[model samples]
Target chain A: MIRPANIPRLLLTPAILTTVVTLGVCLVVLLVLSFGRQNYLDIELGLSAHNFELALTKPLILKLMGKSALIATGVTALSLILAYPIAYLIAFDIHKNKLLWLILFTLPCWISYLLRILSWKLILGYQGVVNSSLMGLGLVDQPIDALLYNSNSVVIALTHAWAPFAILPIYVSLEKIDRALMKASGDLGDPPYRTFLRVVLPLSLPGVSAAFVLIFIPTFGDYVTPHLLGGPTGFMVGNFIAMQFGASNNWPLGAAVALVSMLTATLLVCLFIAGSKRAVRAIG
Target chain B: MKNGLERWLVEELECGRIDRRRLLKMMGAAGVGMAATTWSASALAENNLTILSWSGYDIPEMAPAYFDAHPAPDFTLMGSDEEGFQKVHAGFRPDLGHHTSFIVGKYRDAGLLKPIDRSRLTHIDDFFPELEQIVTTDGKLWEAPLSWGNSSVIYRRDQVEVTDSSWGLLWDERYKGRIASRDSLEGLLIVGGLYTGAADPWEMTDAELEKAKDALIAQKPLLRFYWSSQTDLEQAFANGEIVAAYGWNASVAMLRKQGIDMALMKCKEGIVTWTDGLVMMSGGSASDDLAYEFINAYMSPEVGAFLINSYGYGSGNAKAYESVTDDRLAELGITDPDVVISTSKFQREISAETRQRYQAVFDEVKLS
Candidate 1:
């Protein structure tokens, strides 16, 4: 039998190794393809930065990437706000069977991601649940057409889709908090709000930070939600990438776009990590 | 009843005694596949005849008699010609695939397709002359013509007063926040070409392209969304969110069924039309004989009648119209093949550089 200390690392090795090998090869291939000239079926092997130049120099691509960043930022912020209360309730108010609450919270995740998004589509459609209810109640004469197929709908779906991810991390951080600190703060004649502000909030920053990163990165590259829900106005950089690879058959340009987006994501993640670490250290 | 001539021809071809040209010429004169297919009805040992085709083409309604005649081919539906091209290029070889005539040259050059044996197709002579001309290159046929249709402007009859059926209607400022457009660059460039009054919408000059891009960019704010699917377009139209958009004949047909008060416009600049059909893939496990059986089955007048009676697309086989009533043809807005061929701008293959530029320009308009 393996020692308890080594068990975590042992279990993690295969997953890590698999990801590294597969992703490493993919990244290498993508890089090579990005520099080659694309001629329909024939990709000539001369080194060229034309595709990169094409991808980066486009003012529209930059604008779309900016829109994607803004949308991802909104999703992260909304997820954090919506998830905090649930995580807090589960960690503090629900004294027993916390695992049950976590499961219930994660039940939406057990279903396929596509199905869940589709359900949201049905809900937010023109003659959807909300519009029908409003019409049935005699509050509106016609079904509201603005509920679905826009950037707002995209954000709403993404926030709902990623909320569980936010909840788990926040719950873990909140659960790991020492009870003695809260009691000690209360014993010093500090009110509950002040105690939470001083101790609980600062302690949960790591989890909040983790949850933000977890939601932000994937949401930035999300094309499916936008393509289905966002309509034209909601299209992001990811959809552009998909178009290049799929319909345009421009693998070189697609790879370049992917590389540029990855670099942008990496830079943002690093900055977030550094900033969050400093915030945690200063608070402690 | 198998004729002695057909038996001799089949045996001679099997024994490698004749060239494809001689066979085609003989078949063209005598109607070979039809005569042979009538007699050759036994099942082959092979189990699969894989087909990669459009979504509606795979449906039983399009080819009802085909399923009863032979074992069902594994159907993988394709959304776009480019997607089908890329899939086949990446080595996803189905026995037969649906592709546009414009890309036939590219696919043939890539060696992704084998030359279709016209002698094996019973309905080759039944195809319209316009379709026959498109499918043939250097007197060698590459694909079997299946269906032809127009890319038209679909608008609400109740809301929009579109008197002049022109591509310029999409750019109108009155329909701001009520326009739904396609995200496809090829489709957009076609519209752009029409807007700029270019004779050939598929091949635009740099100046014409600039004008197209400018016009699209100007119209960007008016669009509610750029739709990627039929479902997206239908919902938008149904809810009165979008009053006008570009769509195919099938989508318009579906929308009218839902009582959406939709009408397909016959643009003054002539609508952009695409002709797509089945081409034999180069590599497959199925024997040439079995593949020919499947092709011949699909080419029958019964299958042609099914295609016209169900979908709004024009059947490739001219004789299929013999089974369709005048009322049905009137309902579908098809006068005849000559009229559709004359009034529509059929797409030609654009150069790679032109395609790339169009993609870039469209991306600009969409993002801007």
Candidate 2:
């Protein structure tokens, strides 16, 4: 009864089942819930689009969405800029103990994410490490209150929290680059900077795009960092979504906000990938 | 007072109901604990009693008589009454649970509670009559009042200059960037209503709601941050990061204990009062006798004294005041329960629709 042709299909059964059960089922539930309405502590199941209408049209929600996108864009750009150099060093410059260096570079990822974010609070608080050191050095007469509890702090904390994610993909892509291409560019009388611009950077666009999608998607929906560090002006769309479920006690509205946010992120990420692919083709 | 959100998140993570990877992926999704214990045939037959309560009240000190008589009941700590209601609504049955006064009506309407049998409670007459009246609806006692307190401005006396003790201190132009307010909808909106002189802070009309929203928007720039954690507020006070904040009695007591010159202002525009207590859950598998014994023990003066002394909350039992000294009672800001009750404005229950509107207004102010 067991044929070789059926072996591959049987082997794929668990993965397909897992995806359907875990991701597909939950998404369907979320979509259904978004169409429902809240009746006190209970949700009245219906096929109404009232929640979606409100989520899309509310000015407050729109403002928060714009703010979240801005913050996420900042975090992504910062992460790529900070990650690329270190990734480059590990991929091209370092030859001995490269694995050890990679491990050392990503060691911060071993800590709990909550602890890592909290540590940033201690470093950036009013009387934090930076301020205390500056005051001790007689750099200023008063502590710099601007260092914490702002949009910049949120960006800083998110950039640090997501650095390893950006670095690993970039490292892999950089490592995969054929060294012969760079040598060929140099043999054609191109300078080192020109060779890097022509041969190395274009090849790394795949990893750059991967890192962009990875960082932007999560940071766009991040409420914890903004809640902890983003003072009043730093509140994001994620916080608004969370309020619906908590103090607002409107799960359907929360679900609508979440779905809307997800769809927007998906569209933006698709556009980014397409744009980057075209650029890579043009450069090649 | 409700526990901070961070503690709730940590509890969810520890319970294996939520994993860290999923938490990061969701990017701050509210944790709803849906993993109720699956009782085996033998486990169900044993019929263990489960009590859901606030984090600190789950301890044996709160109900010594019941704990001494029975084997320790299964305890689950709630971060907020909403979360507890959600758990029970999702079918996580517990024999008894704690809830605040404002939510009792919702619980009653949802058919999640059973009216108390007043005759079975030995300490029924010892409770403050006013509090008893608060917990009663339609001639039936729905919850046993456990503790009561006020939410008002707690300021560092030495650091700030105050000409008058009023809610206006929160919006004072002089203390801009040195003030913090609560991050909750009810907490901020009620304060906004009181400051704007709304006829009824809880039942504000559309015009009153907009006034409150405008007042809150004007005050937003003055706030250092909207604090959700008592510990964080206290730390900020200690470090002189904030001179004044909207806070609870426990924060005042803790900061004073740390030798900070902290003072709980007697607001000219009445303080926000709240009471929380124990409620028996309907369809609880535990025996009626055990549930009655647990409620009776919590209502006893011994437990009440412990609650007042340790947590800086006013006990529901008037007789519990006899055990505490006049000085300690004064320090806790409840020297006379009758006077405090007469002077303060109790938080009233709002319908779901009204609450949604209030939340919308609050969100608009925060976003603006």
Candidate 3:
């Protein structure tokens, strides 16, 4: 810092400028709408928290917000759980063909995500292939209605959607670990499990945190999954906000809802960073 | 085990964010919803008229023949009625909008429309008198009638036994969880009102609506799915997810055209009828002459018949069937327009309190 140069600032200027422009546009628009009086059918400007009040008060709105949070959280946790083992195996166990396997694991990322979700519906609907196969095999005489348009289906679809996102980060973190540390832990009379707990797990926290933040943020505001497979009963807050702006014409309320979710996510990310810092300090 | 992993690998191979949207719908409704918000003033000297409508409803094939003869007018497509309402309030200007009759009163009250000039509309009398009366307030016509269809039983005659014309099959235990319905609060609420024998679905008493809601809730267990699109509903029928689902007159012919064997039963609980009417916006009244001209020309028997063949709904012009062959009329089940109207009530506008109550019931019904 004492020798800070003009070149470094210039090098960073483009990235900082891009982020500022992107966030500035969004921030100004959302801030403007959040404080206005934009109702479903009419726009009468007033200085009131009517939009925020509606966000806080409406049972339907709050319920959808809660559902969005829960779905996002569940998707993140499940993705981490499912991806960790594969990521670990790819990074540590399959050193001979690691790149080939990694490439293979990421192939689904190339296809459209919406197409994959639609495929699940094709397999889960009443006359879907899975239902017919189940009936044909006499597993049960009836198609399982629960297999479609519920929290369970959303979780399955979202977890599948977010699996790759979780895997790559954990793999990167795991790959970056020092081999000497693992050998040292093993030489200290620790078992493989202890070595993993003492060496690998703590180092992977950064990647896990990154995965959680990345998956949680997008899933928190996902609009299509619930619409396509979630059905009318599968209402989510994102869907409500979408309707508010789209069909209901309530811009202020939608903006208010969006702002609240963003604030919540910001608090969580900060808390995660702070806690991770404290944990490192305590370990030292 | 490898097969399961391979499928999962194939299914979810991407270790990255993958989100592909099916519908190219814009993210927010703020712009689209406000698309109909009336303008503060009209630059009146202009002769052009802007019509707000469903995309398919504005198809030149279904539009007035003279529209092609004259310079084509401007159009804005709305996603739904709610969106149309929002767009108008947000100052998205349109010269005309074809909304259900229920909204005419609110539109007029909100000063969003101009009274129809019947003298300028040559084929105004061609519309069923019932529609004229239904869309009127205090002996003044607000919007000109366009077309009408009933929310009746559309089922596969080949699959389900058609024992009754009532809405009973919507909750038949034999077909539990294999039925489908439209995903509208009004469609379900009004249909429930009729199912419980309410005198008028549009004006059902609160207690009666609660009962109607319970009936809908009972049907939830019987529903295969609730559809918001032709693609979903069409797929449901093709895949046999639904046996006797709520369908449009359009769907009946479309399904038949796709070679999907199905039938539209004249459900005995009569039919829950809805109508669309063209209203002149307040700001666009300067172009009212063009609007009225289009309206009249759009209601010609040939235009009306073309609409029937195109959209599966009958046009308001009573003589429209005369321009069509018996096979075409038979294909549409339009031997008599008056008879169909008699079996229906024009969905009337309700107070917001009443709409919210019905919506609440609709939510309960879905979760139930």
Query: Pick by lDDT: which candidate is best?
Result: 2
Better of 1 and 3 by lDDT: 1
Give i-RMS (Å) per prediction. Answer: 2.4, 2.2, 4.0
- Candidate 3 has a DockQ of 0.23
Query: Recovered native contacts in candidate 3, as a fraction?
Result: 0.28
Point out the worst 10-residue segment of candidate 2 chain B by lDDT: B33-42
Q: Rank the candidates by lDDT, best first.
A: 2, 1, 3
C-alpha RMSD by candidate, in order: 9.5, 5.8, 9.4
Candidate number 2, chain A TM-score: 0.93
Give the DockQ ranking, best first: 2, 1, 3
For each predicted model, how many residue pairs clash, with residues at least 3 apart or on different chains? Answer: 0, 0, 20
A280 in model 1: Cα distance from truth in Å? 6.5
**Poorest 10 consecutive residues by lDDT, candidate 3 chain B:** B15-24
Q: Looking at model 1, give its docking quality level.
A: acceptable
